[model samples]
Target: MDALFILTMLVVICALAFDFINGFHDTANAIATSVSTKALKPRHAIILAGVMNFAGAMTFTGVAKTITTDIIDPTKLEAGSLFILAALLAAIAWNLITWYYGIPSSSSHAIIGAIAGAGITAAGFGALKAEGFIKILKALIISPLLAFVIGFILYSIFKVVFKNFNLTKTNRNFRFIQIATAALQSFTHGTNDAQKAMGIITMALIAANYQQSTDIQLWVQVSCALAMGLGTSVGGWRIIKTVGGKIMKIRPVNGVAADLTGAAVIFGASYIHLPVSTTHVISSSILGVGSAHRLKGVKWGTAQRMVITWFITLPISGTLAAIIYYILNLFF
Candidate 1:
């Protein structure tokens, strides 16, 4: 096989691998609230999340197309397959590092930053498509803030509405409600997160001249969805613990509120074909709900630590990608 074809294959594998890791990493966020609230048993939650994620992944290609054509044009990238490969490698490395440490970092940021970094390294700063890049950054920054606001407001309303109700009965009712919300959250997670890998694969196809245009092929979608589904089954216990319990003591009511808030923000972003970090949105939702429910109950220390990690992920992943690109370029 020609070098280009081989490189394309490598990109496809790496992209799917990224999706798989993303599934377990972020799927934890989708189901953490439910599991923590005892709304679903851990095994049941994983199964539900895996199925929902697959269903959601197959539902949209708009975000994938955005990732493919935006950031930096695959059409204009020379030897771009190498850049993408380095990006995939860097993103995977960052994700694994965070996963090992149980930090709920953004896989979306890692890949996007890696792509930008690799592209910049290959062709300098001019390689970036400024408008699209800025738009994505806005979505990433704004979604978590939106999630926080919605979560705070929603839980405040819940408190007022259920104030007169029996506490035990209310928790029971909300626990049942959390089951549905968990599925919705996972579905929404699938809609946004799975598309990133799809975009990466499409970029590879274009860069290698295997395909033209930003349209995602059916096989690519199916493969990515399956990879993610399988990954979800593995579960991300460490990150799950941080998001589910360390952020706050999540009651069923609190879980439902956070779940609804995260689902709304994520689905809204997916509707507009924007990629946002599921980890950030979900974690922020919990923090918001905790603050609304009881300010002192919120773990500001843990929140501060997670926030610091979030701010650093972009630059760190980008720099790491640039470094990997140079090293990979040396070999190929």
Candidate 2:
């Protein structure tokens, strides 16, 4: 009924919508490898990823807390709901743009940068919580590199361990194993990615005086999880194709290695309450695995394109958010 409540409702709706988009956009991150290796059909992979993502989303809240307090404090935000709305809109816009072009962009970077951009626009650069903001930036920057290194190392170890085995038999075994790894990767993806929406919704609650502290409510978590699961069911075939085959010719063994590396990196970040891009980690892991298998086998052109998108997402999303915030502020 009141202006504040109306704005808060808008934020909740938009945040959930963003989460739904994220699910489909990043679905490839979880299941691309398995699908590429013929471990699962597209439909079956989507279903499995959807279920695992829901379970994982319901399992964590630390990352949600980080999103609530980091970058900028909700309590201190001026017209906080409007700021969040701008950020969500900007992020959603960027996401759709990338998805349409089939670029495996970072939703995490889009949202974080949007928040920072809108926050700075609303209250200037000083409004940001420098320490927490920098911490998240570091996590985003370091995660993909870590995934690459781990993927290279893990696959190299696999190569040594399986060298004497028959190639066809090894591929067959790894294909089956990829199913489990894909599920784990999806689960880990949900643990981190779904929480971003939960955090944004919780921030809206705090800003509207409907809640206290950064603790995520059960309803918020469940709704976000459901939104993500439903989105995953829709799938992202374009992205699946790109991540699965364009980056490299992924064998079953390579899929398993990348899945394991992605799962480990994402889960570790979630455990420490840092948000990392599932897209970046998964793609980088694949790149790492491909390089380990054969230096020239990895498609450097695709890798270069993805890396360019990654570096540009943050600044572009942030600028878009800033522009959106100013426009929204005029009305609200």
Candidate 3:
């Protein structure tokens, strides 16, 4: 293979690696509530999440197409092996840092931010699409609020409907429902998250002249999904504990409500080809559920910390990617 071919292969591998980490890091988003409420054991939840995540990837290509063609100008990116390597490394590094700290950071934002930073460093600000960035910004801003409202309203309705029922009976009933909700959440997760990797891989392929259009191929979708599913199976235990157990004590009813609300928001976003953060959705749903009971039930400190992380993720990851690209340019 030529040097360009090898570098392209490396970029695909690294992009998939990021997808795996995306799954591994964010497993807590899908199964955390089910696991916390004892609706599903951790092992079983991970297995189920992994399978559905894989299955979800087979469904669509619109989001992938958007990422590859609309987000950044392909012509402006340096068509060099080292540039790709640096961008991937920057994403991976940011992923690891947040994962280690057990922060529910946005992997989607991290990767996009890294690409933007690397692209700007290589080709200047003109390389990015302002409209595409605005779309992403809108998703980031709107998704959590959507999730919160849905979760709050759904939980409130549940409370009202079950007002006369025994609490134990309600919990038992919702435990069964949580199984379905968890599955739906996993499906949405796959649809949204897997497409991101597909987008990156498709971009790499376009750069390498392996295809004619920026559309994602079926194989790319399958591979990205499978990689993410496998990553979910391995699980991010630290984050799992943080989200599932530590945030608030989840019961079956609240868990089901949170999962359903999150699934709905994510599914809506996916249908619109908007890449929203599953982490933000789930966390906001959890907060909504907690606050539905009373403000005191939600842990303000933790929520504040998570919000701070959310605020910092884009800039921090972007700066990191820019620095990494600068350094790699020295040697490559």
Candidate 4:
């Protein structure tokens, strides 16, 4: 077999693996609140999320394009396959580590940082497209903060609008409404997160001379969607526990607000072809809602830990990717 062919296959397999892990790892982002609030049974919520996520993945390719060309040009990098493989390994490691710990870290941050680290290590600072990389970084940083503000404002509005209603009746009504919002949030997650793997696979194709245009092939899209959907079926119970309950005692009204904010922010990023952290956005939305509900009700300790993970993930993943690239280059 041709060496490039073997490496390309490896990239595809690893990329899909990353996508699979992403699905289970971030599944909590979509269905956590609904499950916590008893708005949807856990089994039903996962089923809904899996189907909606697949549908959402099939609907967009713009973010895939960004992942293909923005951070580093696959065509220009030296030993590009090794670079991508190292990135996948590093990202997958970070993801599994965080998921095991039940930490709501950013998968978006992990993959992006790993790619950047590997690229720079393989080809130096010049390998990066400063303009596009910076743009992506900004989106990652800003979106969660934006979600915080949006969630805060939306919940505030909800409080005033429903303040006159009977509490029990309102909670009962919002529990039903949360079902729809949870599905929307999951769909939005598919629109953005699944594309990361698609982008990685497309970049591998380009680097290995198996493909030309940055346009995502039909096979790539379907495969990524299936990988994510299948992974979603497995469910990440640890994450569900952390995000659904640890962040705050999620009420139906709070869940609805957070779901709306997360969906809006993720979909907005997808439309613009920017990748943002769904984990960060969803968690922040919940935090925002908690703050709105009552300042003290939000568990500051758990939120603080998650925030610390977000800040550290990028640099650590990048460094790991760089080290992994160096080691892989020794063999491949």
- Per-structure clash totals for the candidates: 0, 0, 0, 0
TM-score list, all predictions? 0.99, 0.99, 0.97, 0.99
Off by over 4 Å in 1: none
Q: Looking at model 1, which ten-residue stretch has the lowest summed lDDT? A: 70-79
After superposition, candidate 4 runs with Cα above 4 Å error: none
The window of 10 residues in a row where model 3 has the poorest summed lDDT is: 75-84
* Deviation from truth (RMSD, Å), model 4: 0.7
- lDDT per residue for candidate 1 within 1-332, as digits (tens), equals 98889989999999999999998888999999999888999999999999999999999988998999889886777888999999999999999999999999999999999999999999988989999999999999999999999999999999999999999999999999999999999999999999999999999998998888788999999999999999999999999999999989999999999999999999999999999999999999999999999999998999999999899999999999999999988888
Q: All candidates' lDDT scores?
A: 0.94, 0.95, 0.84, 0.95
lDDT digits (tens) for residues 212-317 of candidate 2: 9789999999999999999999999989999999999999999999999999999999999999999999999999999999989988999999999999999999
Which regions of candidate 2 deviate over 4 angstroms?
A: none
With a 3 Å backbone cut-off (N, CA, C), the pairs that clash in candidate 1 are: none
lDDT of 4 by residue, 1-332 (tens): 98778888999999999999999999778999999999999999999999999999999999999999999998997588889999999999999999999998999999999999999999999999999999999999999999999999999999999989999999999999999999999999999999999999999999998889999999999999999998998899999999999989998999999999999999999999999999999999999999989999988999999999999999999999999999998888
Tens-digit lDDT string for candidate 3 (251-323): 9988988999999998888898888889999999999988896678787888888889888888877788789
Greater lDDT among 1 and 4 belongs to 4
Error of 2 at 25 (Å): 0.1
